[model samples]
Target: MLDVEVSSLGPGVIERALGCLRNGHHAETDVPYATLSSLLERAVEAQASDVHLVPGYPATFRIHGELAPVDGEALAPGDVRRMVEAILPERVRGRLETERNFDCSVAVSSGGQSHRFRANVYLAQGNWCACLRHVPTEIPTLEWLGFPDALAARLASHSNGLVIVTGVTGSGKTSTLAALVSLLRRDASLRILTIEEPIEYLHPVQGGSMVTQREVGRDVDSFADGLKYGLRQDPDVILVGEIRDRETAQMALSAAETGHLILTTLHTRDAKGALTRLVDLFPQDQQDDVRSQLALSLRSIVCQHLLPSAQPGQRRALALEVLHNNLAVQVAIRTGKIETIESAIQTGKREGMFLLDEDLQRLVSAGQVTLETARRYASDPAAIKATKPAW
Candidate 1:
């Protein structure tokens, strides 16, 4: 059922768990805990991005951009349910049994090292299933994430406005946002507040910043409600984990307009897509108002992608498209001429703006990635090919 490894989750988190699982419903008489634990250790050793446990299928690990099966027998349905229940709270366990879905994060400490994961557990075709994304303990800096230090600083320099990190799922949005927060906390004595679901990376009290983190469902009912209360909490900078709904988006925009630096994530592919998603979130009657509000408070949008690295054992390479709001960007957003914003970005490279395709081409030229790989993930394959280095 729930595959938490003993060494991984540490003594306090799972001591009573094994005993409970031993007497669990499944016919598993032997301690099945080691089965899940060994799998996790192997995943970490392989530098995997995610781990998956699905009934009727062997345990799977996602390495780089590919998923591969590990050595293991397919678990029975009852065993899957039992494994999931071991770590879930009683209320969540009941909900999972009834509703068959939930999202949560887990932390494991083993061999004197700590590891965290962001996970979503659900039912698949009447079988229990879960996918877990690994979160590293040591937070990386902007330089480590492959962003220009100057541009990163400019984005974090905003005292009051909206800054968004947009990307698809598993595109490293959480890591980049944490890096920005870590960098900001280094010297600024600002009051930073974050509302996350299961809180990915912890930002403790730094020398100059008072960092407070709250989780959704656990600490707050929802992001929208959290923002409403967060505004009244006297926070200098607020972090909304993700603005999926219109209410949360509206509250985030309002917070930005009302003199608070708001950082958040969106599942848009690029800079222009981020703009479109914001206005399209509202109904037709409110589109114009949202456009205006977004235009006024939009400080920057950083869209990123992780490309497979050519070097053996090296991590993924980050390609980003940065759009810092300027006179032209503001005009395009407010006037509903967002399609024209691309040319502005291309010509605004001197002002720290760049296209995603151009950045991919840079990686190809640097020999860090192949031209084929670059073109595969590029916004425009033709554009990327036109600038391909003669290798």
Candidate 2:
């Protein structure tokens, strides 16, 4: 049976109280806040990517793609609700009540250092639940994120056109986008602007470029609004956190067409699917225009997948499809010959473009990853074997 705690004080206070108790210290008041803080500290210590607070279950932490329940009594629905509500601001609480779901940013301090979190609080099974994703304090570099040197170099030097990083949730899309933005920042003379929903990574203007990051709800109403204003900001580089709607997509294409380098992400399975999704986002009447714009402004598409490494207790490896815009590829896009893009990628190795299968095969041949794992994620298994080493 789950433990039930009746507390009107709220989850934040409860968390702090728990933290104090867990740390062998006592709090005079606000026991809930201490408890919540302690839970977060434990999650950080365990290197968890996300912490889940759900009704009828023990608090859970996701570490390396697996969820483990914290060793404690399960929480009742009321306790979960109170804890979640306590952390949210009044405005966010009002929005959650109206919308039944809310996305907000949370900052917590520990050991005199602050950590940021992207939180999604929603109603599940008629009970309030929350999931918190940890946001790193500093932007990660390409090498730090384990991207290939050649691929990172290409993304850094592309002066104009659109470059997209596509992946599903938790696939490190944001990390890759941050790496590219960081690379551009090193160029000193560039002006960069980014629009994100609940802004995850915060980049400091270290070298040449001046960067401005805007959050969707805080700085702007929507992704389209940011893109609309981004054009007038005189930015050399524009980073759209996600191409969510048709208006934003059109805006991104226009930015690319106007000679500004645009970087963004999408949720897609593969490189071919990424292009198809972009073109399909518009109405049939506008698709032709979208295709033309895309063909002209498309620079590169990098589709990444994170796979658990063969070695235990190690980080995941990224398999990527690096697509560069060339004449044949552009023609394929303009003519709606999306199927031909894969063959073009296969033959365009000399031109710095690589299909996902090619990258998987290289990893398998080098013994960095297994052929079985490569086949599981490959778009075409037959193509993967062609790159295998001879026994």
Each model's C-alpha lDDT? 0.80, 0.79
On a 0 to 100 scale, what is the lDDT of residue 260 in model 1?
97
lDDT of 1 by residue, 269-327 (tens): 89999999988889999988998998899999999999988785678889888899998
Query: Per-prediction TM-score, please?
Result: 0.91, 0.89
lDDT of 2 at 344: 82
Stretches > 4 Å off in candidate 1: 1-30, 386-391
Model 2 lDDT on a 0 to 1 scale: 0.79
Stretches > 4 Å off in candidate 2: 1-29, 381-391
Error of 1 at 90 (Å): 4.2
Candidate 2 weakest lDDT stretch, 10 residues? 1-10
Number of the top lDDT candidate: 1
lDDT of 2 by residue, 1-391 (tens): 0112222334355444444444544222345444555676667778888899987788899886678898776676656555555555555656756776778877666766667778888888888788989888888889888787887888898899999999889889988888888887886588889898878888874776799999888789999999998889899998899998888998899989999999999999877889999999998998888889999999899898887666665667788887889998899999899999898887788878887777788877776666777888888887666356442
